[model samples]
Target: MALCDIGLIGLGTMGSALSLNIAEKGFDIAVWNRRTKVTHAFKAEAGELADKIIATETYEELIAALKSPRAIILMVPAGGPVDDQIAQLRPLLDPEDMIIDAGNANFHNTRTRAASGEPFIGIGVSGGEDGARHGPSIMGGGPKESWDSVAHILEAISAKYEGQPCATWMGPDGAGHFVKAVHNGIEYADMQMIAEVYGIMRDGMGMDAAAIGGVFEAWNKGPLQSYLIEISGEVAKAIDPKTGGAMLDAIVDAAGQKGTGRWTAIEAQHLAAPVPAIEAAVAARNLSSRRDARALGEELFGAAPKHLPHETLSIDTLEQALIAGKILCYAQGFVMLSAASEEFQWSLPLPAIAEVWREGCIIRSAMLNDMSEALTEDPERNLMFAPYFSDHLKKNHGALRQVVAQAALHGLAAPALLSGLSYFDTMRTARGTANMIQGQRDFFGRHSFVHIDGSEGQHGPWAD
Candidate 1:
């Protein structure tokens, strides 16, 4: 029997799809699952691609089936399961054989694993099951040699934007996962901003699911066009089979998360990076999960959300506002990435990050294509300041301000939008209220303050 080109353990949803993707790309793959039946079932269901798959019942067989100096991808859950798999595989494999952890791992864990002197690499894979089976953006981080060893296969199977594959080496150690975390953070903000717009349509405009879906469908053709917006339209337009009503209407309002967004917010705080849009998105999701609290609060406060006056806002204005919010959210995410790049010494490629995101990922959008060019011109500058994006903001932020203000007036909770507007406002202000904060801190904690006139650490007069 020919040795498999690569091996994948944990034949879960992503694993099964990715294995098929590998096999479909003409690479032989050895696969294993904890349960013997799952492994066989995957091979059995693989159709013609089953010819390229070697299903193994045991770790020994899984390891033996791969070529010498083998690389195996672990699709297990992040944290302990990944560590457990690595520990088990370490003894069975040679020092040169690499283990690739491909789950939504915490970057810190990836860093620790890479530093353990083992042949390990961590890659962040984005896109859901369908993308896994066809193509998904792949962000790789580890020793350059480890990434180089597998780059061909990764690029071969990854999603592409205008023929450029969306798989590339991020940097050493946990850079891939760090970029992925930021990707997810932006995804959170993107989704929240969309939801907020949807809420305005649903509650404020008195539009039903179909009408709201129509609005999203129209927006999909414009600057806001993206996977999330297109899918939102599809979701809104879908009809319930069990009931005659809209499928989206039947769904619960609460959203579920897998902790990646929360991780992004936590990591941003650690880096002293201001990602308020992402932070607000995470907070909104947390708040949404508290259905009972929200309901009780609604009852106590007498249901603050009411239908807006007919002339209050337009779908066109909402689209422009969403455009502005998206720019701000992505700007904050890139700044956070820049901060993390410095703190981690990774020298991450900001333009490549945007390039990869232009296709496969949830946040993929036409806007990112412009962003790639803008960042290539100057990666150090904040994205909002980039001429292309700055031009867009100048055209759109008025609509954003109006939407945020109206949302507030109507008692709508547009946290992510509000945060973006606040961040944008703060960024444009050269001298602000922070001097008052500095004085207060000096008065209470003697932290001292610096004056604009080239003075260093001076005590406040309040100390007397």
Candidate 2:
């Protein structure tokens, strides 16, 4: 077998797709799997790309098949499995050879591994199985030199937007995974907000799946144009083959998660950064899992969702409200990213991060193009404060407030949308309720509050 450009472990869906993509990009890649049969099957089914793949059954053969000072990618499950693989590879691998964890890992583990004086990097790859086979957005971290050695291949395999690859170096240590967590957090909020609107259309407006899908399709042609929106349209448009009814109606209401969004929420709280929309989305998922509890509540409360008449709210207004919610949600995500950057001293490029998310990633949207431009002008400022987005908020916020009010009046659970509106309102306020909160805290806990009159420490008047 020819000496391969890279060695990949774990011949699972993502690993197989990525290996084929590498071979398609004209790089010779060596591959292995925990199950030897999987490696053999992958090679047998590789078709023409098999010519560029050297499938090995063992770690030693995989290493031997790669070129000197080799680079190996681990596509195994995150956490313990990654550690076990690295431990297995350490004795056979040279000091200069790199171990890249291309899984959705918690960034703290990445930081520990990166700082271990080893040739290790943790990266975040998005776009799922199809994207891995074609192109996905790649976020790389660890040493610049380690990244540079693999940049050519990563860039070639990344999705492109306007001729630019959606792959980039996102600072050192766990920066890439941290950014990926935030990406997932934003994705959760985006999907939640979209689902919230879909609820409004279905339950409130009494629209069927096809009509709701049509709405999503129309939205895709405008600022809401995105992979999620486009797919939402397709999902809604799908017909159930068995009963010939709406596909969405046939499916269960529960949404499943793998915890990246939760990780983002936890990390944000750790940094004392506000990401209310993402947090609300995470909460929504948790709430959705309790089908029994919801049914019980409906039985106990004697209140079901009442329809919102179209005379009071239009689909156009709902679209505008979704637009505003998306803006607020993203602004919160970016601010959380800024907080992480400051706390970790990663110097994460917020503009470049936006550009990287412009294609391939789930959150890729037409709005991100404008966000990239805006963040380029001032990366530190809130995205809503950007000239383009600020104008958008100005025009759409009233629609958002209206939608939120309507959802409340009727019995719809639009937590993400409501959270987005609350965040937007809080951000625009000058001198707000935090002072009252501080005073209450001081009266109870004696934590002390900064006086408005420039006194260093102050206490609330508790009838003392």
Candidate 3:
């Protein structure tokens, strides 16, 4: 039997697509799955590419099929499954053999697993099902030396932005996964902001799904052009065949998450980074899930007020607000990434990360091209402080403020947008109301407040 260049464990949708893509690139691949039937099915469906694939029945067979200094990519579920697979593969593999975990596992776990004896690579793969079959953005994090072993294969299967591959070696021990988590967090905020804008168009302007979809289509041609906006437009226009109503209207309002967004929020809190927009998005999802509470609240406190007249809303203003909200969301995510980089001593290359996200991923946008350039120009500065984006915020924040104010007055739920506006406003303020909060804390709990001149241990007197 011919030796395979790489071995892959898992024949799920993502794994199968990725293996086909790699096989098409002319690399011999050995594949294994927990269920033997899955491997058989994959080989049967491989068609002309079957010649490049070797389907193995056991872990030992999978390891034995690979070439010297073997490499295996694991596409299992995150957390415990990843560790279990590592334990099983450890004794079968040599010290130089490499194992890459390509799931959405927590970065901390990746770090811990890498510290073990195995030559582990923690990679974050994005771009969903279609992208996996064609091209995905690949972020690899592990020992720098291990990257060279699989870099060519990764670059071959990754998406390209302006002829450049959307794959890069990020940093050692979890940096890739950390960045991927932040990407998902920003995705959550982006989705929530879009939903909020759609709500405004639906309720405030009294537009139907088709009309709202037209707005999203128009936005996709401009600065806000992105995968999310494009899909939102498609989703808005989809009609339910049974009910003959908008598909979105027929579906449940509740959104589901698989923990990446929550992980990002928790990490932000630990790092002291203000990710209000991301947190608000997560909270909004939780709130959406509490249907009984919402219904009860409506009965007790009365339903939300009727939307304002259509004349009160402007599509241009809505677009501006969305752009601003997206900026805030990305800013917060990047801030968390920066904090994590410092805490972990990863020295993450921010520009390269942004560059890889330019295409293939769910958050792929034209804005990332601008971000990549901005970071390249000033590597140390936060994105909001960049001249291009600062100027954009200066011009667009008014629209965000106006939209947020209108939403409040109309009793519309725009939590993510409102949080974005608030975060931007707070960041720009020189002297915030936090001093009063400090004073209150000092008076009640003797927590101590800092003086204006930088003196510490100052307490405020309380009136009993």
Local accuracy by lDDT, each model: 0.94, 0.93, 0.91
Best by lDDT: 1
| lDDT (tens digit, per residue) of candidate 2 on 1-464 | 56999999998889999999999999999999999999999999999988999989889999999998899999998899999999999899999999999999999999999988889888899999988999899999899899999999999999999889999999899999999999999999999999999998898889999999999999999988999999999999999999899999999888999999999999999999999999999999999999999989989997667898757889889999999999999999999999999999999999999999998888998999899899899999999999999999999999999999999999888999999999998888999999989988888888888888889677777826
Clashes of 2: 0
CA lDDT of 111 in candidate 1?
Answer: 99
**TM-scores of all models?**
0.99, 0.98, 0.97
Task: For candidate 2, give the lDDT.
Answer: 0.93
For candidate 1, the per-residue lDDT at 118 reads 83
Counting clashing residue pairs in each candidate, in order, gives 0, 0, 0
* lDDT for position 11 in model 3: 84
Please give the lDDT score at residue 355 for candidate 3: 95
lDDT per residue, candidate 3, 153-272, as tens digits?
999999999899999998998998999999999999999999999998887888899999999999999989999999999999999999999998898888999999999999999999
Candidate 2: worst-modelled 10 consecutive residues by lDDT: 455-464
Compared to the true structure, candidate 3 yields what TM-score? 0.97
Ranking by lDDT: 1, 2, 3
Which residue pairs of candidate 1 clash? none
Each prediction's RMSD over C-alphas, in Å, is: 0.8, 1.1, 1.5
